[model samples]
Target: MIEFVFHTDDVARVRFAFSPLWELVRGLRVLADPSRHALHLPWVHAVRPKLRGLDVGFLRSAVPATDYIPDFLTPPPGTPLPDFAAELEIVRATPPEVVAEELRLTERGGAAGAARRAMAAEPARTLEAVCVQLGRFWSAAVEPYWERIRDLLEGDVLRRTRALAANGAEGVFADLHPAVRWHGGTLFVDRRWDYRGELAGRGLLLVPSVFVWPQVSVMVPPYQPMLSYPPYGVATLWESSPAAPPDALAALIGRRRAELLLALGSPASTTELSRRLNVTPGAISQHLGVLRACGLVTGHRLGRRVLYTRTRAGDALAESPSVQ
Candidate 1:
């Protein structure tokens, strides 16, 4: 079990952020063993062919089958939403000593160990190679679907932040995951090892990831205290196409608008809607304007993005038996 003791100030400091780098690192695990990460099989099938010519041997070795992933590869995001380039720079700048220490810890007796040893021997050189490979991997595999993935992650943060505001930390922790628990002033994470750390008023960073499903990862001292868990609705992330809206609703709102409403079952941004529906952002904005005017949808500003969701009336219409 891992426990993080929080003070009153720490509670107020708890914040949420999105990490593209985290997704890329965790994605490597999913790609390494598609069978264990069945939810991402659709992604694996699509990405494997793209990665055929890329040499990810060092990258693959860094993420062993065990839970220990080299910390240098995934530094917690410093901002709420950092692009891949910003995060990659952080990785590129990791101190050589830190790299050697982490690699040493990752070392074990096997093929993976040999890779780790080689990396430890020349930290700076190996780190650059890892970064280069990561850049290529991201372009081919993650960047293509980032819009959809970011939408899901953003929606999750919005939901959880609201929960935190309405019901405090307890509310957010209630359904976070089976392995996580909160009691009094301490947060507990069930893990193979035991550890205790204090927030020390730095609070904690809550990161929602698309690929860390069915498992939650925690970071401790020498790094920002953070937790990465699968965001809600990740299971449906790779669906080839959206479900068709009810025929009656489609006829009433026009098929395009109805499809937009159905997609808003969870909050989403204009960019997300555009990408998911294969519609232009301009078209999506026009339709959203109509939906808003009709009292069928509402938008809320979360950071730089405004997320749209169905209003109560819109929910009724979407769920009405007559519409089905």
Candidate 2:
């Protein structure tokens, strides 16, 4: 009854917003404190559904398997893998460039990224593989009413909303820290174990699938890898889950910051957040500049415009009780 309808084009928005939007959700979960995380839901409600669909849909695609990510939703600890539609876990961490380095074909026609392979001979096997991957995501957090979910994922407004979630190009890859890069689409990565390890160095942990498709593997970093994986229990999450960090960075900042924080929860043009908050756009920009300096905010581009959001640190600061 959540009435989560979205325009068909919004799904394209999800594809565009695939990255930043994932970080936003992770940031929200990290800044779990009520006052700090209190993003006016109703205000978000007024956002065009196509745009809202992009936010919601991108998050949906980004969720990791429940077993590896405990807080997400899964069976009890020490329980069998029955909870997962796909039975898998990384028994070993592969090293960097594993995907491109060790490319092997399950069949013909290049790799997973090369486009749909020749599967006419084994249509049933191909169909089975697709089902397994779909089931894996479903078990992770796929909705009961998937058709609606799909519709929400795919919307034109979702595409336009890209400045907030995925398509924004800003500091997206500005890290010396080596990354595996498999998580951002472009597949057939599983053949190379080294690539798997590469992502881990950058904090992305892949949950391997026993039921192999051509090259489908579920990746996990931190519950909030989008904001630069906080170097705490990211490794122990699946191998051994960690008690949620008390110093969860996003859980810290105060009221004014919290309001600004929530206002920027998704990327918003300065004019947008200002208009929403009844403040001048210049005033909003000033606050954002401060937040950015502290590593608590980031910006993205949409044409000549820039959109802003709570950085991982910003979310943490906003959520935390004021130490000051």
Candidate 3:
């Protein structure tokens, strides 16, 4: 069990941010044991062939099926919305000593041990090499789908922020995960090892990750007190095809529009919707404009993008069995 005691100020300071680096690192874990992370099998199947000849051996070893991943590889995001380039630079600048120490703490046996030792012996060189591989891996596996992933993450943050406003931290943590518990003035995370610490006013950083589903990760002091949990709706992240709408409704609204309405079951951006439905962005925009004008959809500006979702009337129309 890991306990983080929080003070009044600590509660106020609690903030949420998502990181590309964290996703990339945790993603390696998924690749290492795809069976354990069945939710990500689609991603695994798509990414494996792209990774051919990419030198991610050390990265794979560092993030074994079940073991301690080096902290230096994944520092807490400096900002709420950090790009991959910035995060990669942070990894590139990690002190050689910190890299070596963290790598030494990972599993030490067989190929894993050998990889760790080699990296530990040449931390600076290893850092550069790792950064290069990470860039290639990100382009191949994550960048292609980042828009969809970011939309889900942003929606999650919006939901949690609303929960925080309405019900305080308890509301956000109450249903965060089965292994997480929040009570009194402390946050508890169930883990194989035992640990306890106080926030001491440093506050807590909440990060929602798409790859860390079915499990939660924590970073205690000596680092920012950060928790990365799977965001809501991750189960649907890799779904390539949207469900077909009822034929009757499709006839009422053009088939494409009906499909678009049904796809708005969750908030999504134009780009994300376009990719998911294989429709051009211009067509999506035109359809969304019509939906917005008709009161069937609403759009909210989040960061640089606008996320659209079904309004109450829209939901009713989509769920109406008698639309015929």
Candidate 4:
């Protein structure tokens, strides 16, 4: 068990963030063991053939079977939400010393060792090469689905923030994952190794992940502490079709609008809705505008993007049995 002892100030400092770089790193796990992550199988199958030409050896070596991927390769996100290109640049510029030290931690034998040696001998050149491959890989595999994935992550953060306000840190941690527990001022994680650390004041960053489900993971200290857990509403990613609404509700709002209302059972962005409904963003914007004007859906700006959710009346209308 890994115990994170939080100080009074630490509690106040806890925040949520999303890392494009971290997601790239985690995607390696999905690529390495596609069958193990059945939830991501659809994504894995789609990206597998494209990955055949990419040089992913260094990334694979960094994340050995022990789950001890180096921190330098995947830095904590610079912002609450980071752009993929910006984060990729950060990876490209990782200090040579940091890169060498991290790579040195991997097993010093065979192909893994050879890769590490090449990186250690010329960190700058090797890192640029790796980043080039990552750019290509991200373009092919992750960029297409990032908007939907990002919205789900943001929604999870919003829910957790509300939980924190209503019930405090314990409440927020309680349901984060079954592998995680909060008691007596200590956050305990059921990890393979026994460990303990005091978050003197740096607090923690909670990161929501779609791919890293079933296991809760932490980046040990010396870096800002971060806990990555599966996000809420992950199942929606693989939901190819939205659930049907009552025929009367569909008729009342027009089938497309009703479908959008039912889909807004959770908060989502315009792009997210467009992808889910297989409609154009302009079409979704028009429908959402109408829904907003009718007081059926509400939109709120979160960072640079605005998210929409159903109002109480909207929920009632969508769920009204009389409509059937």
Candidate 5:
């Protein structure tokens, strides 16, 4: 069992902000009579544990722990995060669109396919605990994302979120996060998901909410958690990035492969790339093979699919033709 520490101060802050958030949620529950409400219930339920996980992450980050998840996966402390109203509207804006897309996914092979693949990734008990831990660990630091969304989500979303903020106060959670409670230090935890075997055997992935939001998420080898609320017809679809350090690499190597690299900028499955580039999987494989050999690209295995990413070499190649 993973050891967990809870601070009294953290609890007080959480109770302050969360109590009201819950109240608003309860108010939203009144609309349960509609089909859309039914659709949303499961997502709300699924997010509860993740939200709590984020809160725990925030607390741990404050202790200045060495084991830290990346900042993007978890929100930074003291950041004014997005509240429910904004999220509700974001969902509403494209609710039908998302629903239709999900339905289409189901028509093909998607979450259900992935979930089925993930079943044996860990022992049943371990799997259940991980799911719980994922949520508990995440909520502690879920704010930065909320804040990013708050600033980015405007128009219809802004109006509704502001209305809720007016009722709940915009800065409600400003002081609720543990990061704000204690002295500042670098806080991180392992948000990376681990599977015992090869990624392909278990539907491997990395889902940065950014993938969906800012579209920052990329699938790489080494499985990332799979979030689901099938009952609600909500499923996340991610394009995987090869786990070759695009961030570090993109900066290190930025020019030689600029055209080839940028052409491959969006996340993709091996098969998808083959089709898009008008190349055979084997031909694409040859290019990726050479790239990987040169450290110019990296390959990540996800659920029987391999996603290729441009490595520092590739990024450097992109950075300049003179890098060589």
Candidate 6:
């Protein structure tokens, strides 16, 4: 179990941010183990051939079979959200010794080990190559959906932060992950490796990921400590087409309301629904307002965005029989 001891100051310092580089790294996992992360399967299929041409040696080492990932490869996000270029620069500028050490820990031996050794020999040159490949990968696979991804991530943070505010630390930690627990001023994270760290008033960074589902992870130490958890609505992040509304439900509440109900299979912001339906946000809001009034949908404030999701009643309605 990994334990993060927090002080009163540490609790106040907790913050949320997004990592573009981290997404690129986790996207590699989707590539390596497509079966495990089926949510990303479509993305993997689309980008797989393009990836065959890139030098993925560093990724092989950086993201190992085990949950442990090199912290240097994915540095803690800077305050707010670090841009992909800025974060890549941080990785590229990592001290050679730090890079070698992280790679050695995760790679151990085999092709991954060999890749690390090669990188250690000429750190700057090889780091540049790794960065270039990552940049290209991001543009092809991630940039297109970054806006939607960002909305989901930010919404996750908003909901969690509100929980913390309303119900205190216990409320937030309780649902953070099944593997996480809070007791005696320390937060425990269940992991294969053993780790214990003190916040020392530096606080903990909470990041939401679309691809890092089924495993809640933390960056290995000697880097700023942070945890990455699957966000609230990742299951639908890659949904290519909105689900068709049930015919009976469409007849009952108009096609637009039925579509809105089906879309809320996961929490989504007005902007997201608008983009998905190719309608104006105002139109989406009008429908959402009606759904909210009828007790079919609920909304929560996440930062400036309000994400809406189906109420239990709404779910039943969506699943009700279609007109014969």
Best by lDDT: 1
lDDT of 5 at 73: 21
In the range 77-193, model 3's lDDT, one tens digit per residue, is 867667999889888999999888887784343244777787788888888888898999899888987888889988788778877888887988999999999999889999877
Give the lDDT ranking, best first: 1, 3, 4, 6, 2, 5
RMSD of each: 2.7, 18.4, 3.0, 3.2, 21.9, 4.1
lDDT of 6 at 237: 79
lDDT of 2 by residue, 1-324 (tens): 001112334223222212211222333232222233233232223332324223332222222221112122221112111222222221012222332222223223344322222332343443344334434333333223222222222221222343325543222222212331312332122223232222222322222111111123233333322212221112211211112333333254444445677555444567555555666878777877777888888876644555566667766665556531
lDDT, residue 118, candidate 1: 85
Q: How big is the RMSD of model 5?
A: 21.9
Query: Best by TM-score, which number?
Result: 1
- Please, what are the lDDT tens digits per residue for candidate 1 over residues 210-267? 8888899898875789988888778768866578998999999999999999888878
Pick by TM-score: 3 or 4, better one: 3
- Tens-digit lDDT string for candidate 5 (139-219): 432332333222222111222233335533223222222211112211111223322222223321111122122111122
- Candidates' C-alpha lDDT: 0.87, 0.33, 0.86, 0.80, 0.32, 0.78
Worst lDDT 10-window in candidate 2 = 206-215
> How does candidate 6 fare on TM-score?
0.81
Lowest lDDT block of 10, candidate 1: 106-115
- Per-residue lDDT for 61 in model 6? 57
- Candidate 4 per-residue lDDT over residues 1-324, each given as its tens digit: 889998777778889888776777788887888766788888887887877777776567656534457677677875666788888888777888888777766433323466566666877777777788778878877887788888888878877887788788987998888899999889999986677999987789899888777577788778888889998778777677798877898889899999999898777999889888999999999999999999999987788898888888998898788875
In model 1, the Cα lDDT at residue 214 comes to 80
Least accurate 10 contiguous residues by lDDT in model 4? 106-115
- Winner on lDDT (2 vs 4): 4
